[model samples]
Target: MQQIFDFKALVKYRDRAAQRLGTVTPVLEELTDRLLDRLDDTTSRFSTALDFGGRGVLAPMLKARGISVDSADFSALLAAKAGGTPLPLPGPADFKLTQARYDLIVAPLSLHGLDDLPGALIQFRRALKPEGLLLASLPVLGTLHELRLNLLETEETLTGKVSPRISPFPELRDCAGLLQRAGFTHPVADIEELEFLYANPLALLHELRDAGEGNALCARSRAIPPRALFPAALAAMPRKEGRMVARLRMAVLTGWAS
Candidate 1:
């Protein structure tokens, strides 16, 4: 996709980081708790679940709830590192979905990485049973708007090339529409905006790298030549209250089979 920046290596990097972190952030942990809180425990037969971005955090929760979860990821590295089923992204949902035979599916910050997000959602819907539930949390539109704006301004003024260094996340409306278009019933979506204060751009970049949220769009160029453009672009960004604030927008989406 045109919006993808350094897609291949970036995904690989994320997989590695996931292996290292082995724990979910407070934000994601909270989201997972909410999703789990909404789970219907009336049916003990439907105890099998699937974790799409399961780096290892939700495993304990699912186990505690007596639910067996099949953790999956497109990254062979992540899957192997995390020691679970390794699956391809957005292909052959029937095969994987059947293999797992899950009644609940959870994807935390995983859907946005797909190039064909709409198609992937369709696959997720197909993977579910009539009474199955699908839950996903992804960064949507308005995410990192400040960083994007600053990068654009910097590129325009320095290199005259606005290299979008981030993935194109879908908006909350688009995400809900995608669930419906993919044939999900009772689709619900909520937008959550998080503002993180950074000491500077370098610090922000470091956090992004550690979080594995750095650029991964394949269409993007990853070359950085040693020239005045680099410094000039960095200088173009503005400081806010003596610090830089980057705003991130994430959407929590849930749906059920019809």
Candidate 2:
């Protein structure tokens, strides 16, 4: 697959966050809760599951339902923190899984950073037992738009050069199409718009780093940016009720393994 995100960087950031972050990011916790809630709508009882990218939220929930779960993440520490044996990512876009092994696979707010998202989806589908369920969510097009725009404008004003700061995310309309392309049955996709608030722009940045959601685009420059860049850019975001607001357009996706 063509390069997109730096997978190793992603792992490092996640592991660091696992070591240092004291609490869960509200957005992550909310998304995890929302994804698990989808399980309630399904009549089929799942016996086994894979908790991909859960931040100490999903494994407990699935176990509570008496479903045995295996947790996997690029970061081993992250998987351990999620309360399951760590299944590490073998490569940027490739991993081996036993075919027809799981009753359910829940990959929330993950997969978007992958260089080969379609390939990863196909693997997830292949790992499911017959009629198994795949429920996932990812940051779609409007996510982080406020911060992205402000950063771009800030960089342009100071350096007169454009840089790829924010990673590209999938679009909502095409999410279902992705599932179809990966050969999933009964594919469906929908959007959930969420808003979060922070005290200031720096607080927003801090939360992002603490959540291990820092920029991992392969095209991102390694050189240190202007000292004033972040301060100026984040300060420019529009505030609501005296708090800086961040919007997340999440594409909640579902499919069945045939």
Candidate models: Cα lDDT each: 0.66, 0.85
- Please tell me which predicted candidate would have the highest lDDT against the true structure: 2
**Can you give the TM-score per candidate against the true fold?**
0.80, 0.96
For 117-236, candidate 1 gives per-residue lDDT tens digits of 776777776777777888888888888765677666766766677766767777678778888988888888887676766566676666566556666766666688336643454455
**lDDT tens per residue, model 2, 26-136:** 557677888778888888999999988887777777888899988898888888788765676677556777789898999988787788888889999999998999999
Please report the TM-score between candidate 2 and the true structure. Answer: 0.96
Q: In every candidate, how many clashes are there? A: 7, 0
Off by over 4 Å in 2: none
Clashing pairs in 2: none
